[model samples]
Target chain A: MKRRDFITATALAAAFGLAGKPVYNVLASKDALASKTGKRLAMVIDLKKFEGNSEMMNKCVDACHSMHNVPDIEGAKEEVKWIWPEPFEHAFLEQNNQFIPENIQNNPILIMCNHCDNPPCVGVCPPKATWKRAEDGVVMMDWHRCIGCRYCMAACPYGSRSFNWRDPRPKIKNITANFPTRSKGVVEKCTFCDERIVKGLEPACVVASKMYEPEAMVFGDLNDDKSNIRKILSENYSIRRKPELSTQPEVYYLI
Target chain B: MLDKIFTGGKKYWAWMIFLSSIIGAGTLAYLHQYEVGLGVTGMGRDVTWAFYISQLTFFVGVAASAVMVVLPYYLHDYKKFGKITILGEFLAIGAVIMCMTFVFVDMGQPLRVVNMFLHPQLTSPMFWDSVSLMGYLVLNIVISRVVLNAERNGVKPPKWIKPVIYTSIPWAVSIHTVTAFLYCGLAARPFWMSAIMAPRFLATAFAAGPALLIIICFVLRKVSKFDVGKDAIQKLAVIAAYAMFANIFFLALEFFTAYYSGMHHHTQHFQLLYVGLEGNSSLVPWMWTSTVLAAISLYILINPNTRKNEKILGFGAIAVFLSIWMDKGMGLIIAGLVPNPLGYVVDYTPTLIELTISAGIFALGALIISALYKSVLTIRRQV
Candidate 1:
């Protein structure tokens, strides 16, 4: 009878320790894990929709810059942009060899940082000031550590990194009040809205996907079987810009 | 009148005046850069490096080219270069000073130049470059002083100084080699990412640097009635010619490899430079100009007739020097980043702030060179 009582006590302890926790605690842990689970984030951009919808690209740009604190300069050509629209021919000069379109009015893409798997910028940084995160493979910059040598600027084939020749923070609207501002003498690039991602919000550009209806932007973990991005990759044919560079760019487009 | 001035008092003031003007201009430019910032320069995001770096690169080669003179004069005991060995060494000192200042002015924050030391990154070629440059400066000063003092006394230099001077020969080569390694080691930039980069840098350094020295010697001969001698110059020009030959060969090899392989990524940069890839032919004119100048200079140097004339030879050397400077220092490295990874053609232009700062730094270098040369000339006159 004593042995049976000891066995029952041990079983209860094991059950509580291994499988049973407070409901709130369990929910919080699950929420924390929801971000990391093999959701290889990928994009499937439909080029066909971009054929006539210049406004769609502009809307996406507005949403991204507003959240990311991208300043709008008077001369748009001189502006430092995280994402901006480019004509199809200029955007795909290497690939569009002979397929000269009669009417090239349609904007091809609003390309920004590719966030390549084999990022040349990260490889070239002398001070480890820039790095590619293993968690999500997003390349990030540490402004304080940068010496403004511009070697990484030479190293990056993507032309993704922008040096703050002047202080960019002042030109930014009140939006930068909450977000951190970059100082002069360092490189800056797109971070996929890391702050929003941490808070369970999608990238601002991805959230603004509704701007295009026929084939809106879709972002999901590439690793997860149920993620929308993985599903699209399997279902559709897409092309990555400058694949010959072997940078393995994460951004893709679908026609 | 020329002989009197060369042998007497007026020469001292003239040297000082010439040097001070060059240095003064540089200081003024630097001040403007400090007030406004790099925004004044044309340097943009795409072409992050510009004229400042190009000058720095050319000067580094000039600094290292002293090795050619030093090696033969010191190691081989080539008495023919004995009189001018000290001159080459002093010139190197000026070149290095200019090179260092150019890099400093090019920085966004000149105040934070020391930060490179405070937070050192061993992986960076720049860190190694900094260390090597400092080492070279210290060594050059010590060796130059010891030799100059001995020359003044009409006796052999201190036995200890011989080893140090000998050591500087290789150290001279290292200064520029490390500078070249700075670019070549980087794997991402296609123009710089080649095993041949270091060799090419050395070749260009030997050619352009020596050629520059020859021109300077000729200038001194004309202005101050100092003769470095035709024989010495002819030997130096031959060295420059051989180096130029190698530089051209390596460039051709790079062209062949990039084009013959037909790799799109590698070929794109070459196409951009020569063929006006996608209607952005801004660099084409510059590239062609460099090529034509280089060819003409090469022909002049290789031929016996034209090479014999000081006027023709001086012009040839200057042209070759400028062409190589354009090819290696500016166009090759800066224009490498076109049609960026996202396939966007971004243009980079240096602003006025950058230009002023660069000019100021260059002046600073000229000032140093002038001061050094003045001291050497003054001391030699006394002896």
Candidate 2:
């Protein structure tokens, strides 16, 4: 071939390569879009609002459990729960004291996955079955990929994760068709209700709490200073469980 | 060479049959666990890892202890260990097989284990552990095969084998160290999150490994009229003694740090293991038994007169092996998980099925060791 023809052919090939968008570039552009939204989702639980309302707390638990299809297994050893009530002393050991106020001491605090910024569960999962979403700071689990090693359960300092000890399908009282139920031998936890968030809905528990008391549970983006969670955190004194562990828990409790 | 294992005497066949029965029982129990789930064991959400993980931890130490023999034989050119080096290597091959089997049976989804290789998360210590354990297993198998074949043929091993043998010394240490990191790296469990964890694991491994080897040597001497020499046994006893001392020293350091600092998170686990915490005292008796055994074994091991007596040395070795097993294999995992991350104490005891499955794995290890040793003895007899 002539030298001019060879040069022209090479130029045409390079143009096609540049023009036709590679798959990775498209992926990179999608990641860029995720960062553009750049949400750091967070939740703030106002314990004072939940002080005398055990009924309201139960409603929140039921809503989350029913929405997520969490099994109703009996006994603490084999029990699986997404959100549950724990005594104040058990939930916050660092804050326990002999002279604690009667109201605070008597009330059971609500607890769930903190969805940490630096989650140890994500770090310890051997199969990369669980990871923290870069787009939103919510830690997520892939039930199919989890080999059921339970390393994530051991790594979670909050006791937020649970394993399906038996077939969950039989245990489910009423399986939600929209949300998938996990099979036996996989770890499951709250994803900060990523499915609900994607559909522009607040987490079930947050929405449930709104009926009885608007300030009971607050969920919003921490990245946006104007967000409700950020506003609540800034105005009131709040604390997190095991904050010294440096996991940077996204969940806060308003005292 | 492999045919020698099939040609053993009546006693050998009886032992093989004994192990086979246990293995058969274990396989049946494991099938139940497979059809159901890990719930068949005593492991719950709180105490998520129990007997199986502890066995994995214990056997990794046993496997890594092969270094004690290999290092002295090759690195220092200690001719005393020459006769027994192959024994140590074979023992390692058996222990590693047990380690891998324990990991396999403990998984909830045993079939999905290939995901570890397919996905390969570098950040996870479990990933690094699988890599190191697999590497160590391959290294020991290659080194033992080459050296044993050379011995059988009355020739030196190929020049290429020297480097591989040398690589195995540190590789052995890496296997156990990585196993220790699997626990110690977790900041959530204060019982395991200590700087001394790796060193403590090595100390215990060196002690338990040699102690078990000495007992095996004694059995071989009685059963097959195979002696690895008086000097080798004495040397192994001394190695075990020093390692036990280091292990005790590390335990003392942990106790001091926990008590003196008076950190609730740190001291609570120790308190729970030693005494009952919140009415949970299931582990207290076990921990005390381990402590008493350690004390008795240390007394027997440290005295020169007692150490030189092969009869007493055998007892000391058994005591040492059992003591460390109780401490590391039984107490370590339970203490770490109980009083869990939330300071909730949940007692755990392995169910019948769990114990049966574990017994099967132990039988499998014995079967492997017996076959390997039989082959080695057959070769030595020809010489």
lDDT of each: 0.74, 0.91
Candidate 1 residue spans exceeding 4 A from truth: A1-53, A74-77, A100-107, A210-215, A220-228, B1-15, B149-167, B181-194, B222-226, B258-289, B308-311, B338-355
**DockQ of all models, two decimals each:** 0.24, 0.60
User: Which runs in model 2 stand beyond 4 Å of their true positions?
Assistant: A1-37
Q: How much DockQ does model 1 earn? A: 0.24
Q: What's the TM-score of every candidate structure? A: 0.81, 0.94
Judge candidate 1 at residue B73 and give its lDDT: 84
Clashing residue pair totals per candidate (backbone < 3 A): 20, 0
- What overall lDDT, based on C-alpha atoms, would model 1 receive against the true structure? 0.74
Best by DockQ: 2
User: For candidate 1, lDDT tens digit of each residue in B69-156?
Assistant: 8888878888888767877887788788888887877776566667667766666677788788888888888888888778767898
Task: Evaluate residue B108 in candidate 1 and report its C-alpha lDDT on the 0 to 100 scale.
Answer: 68
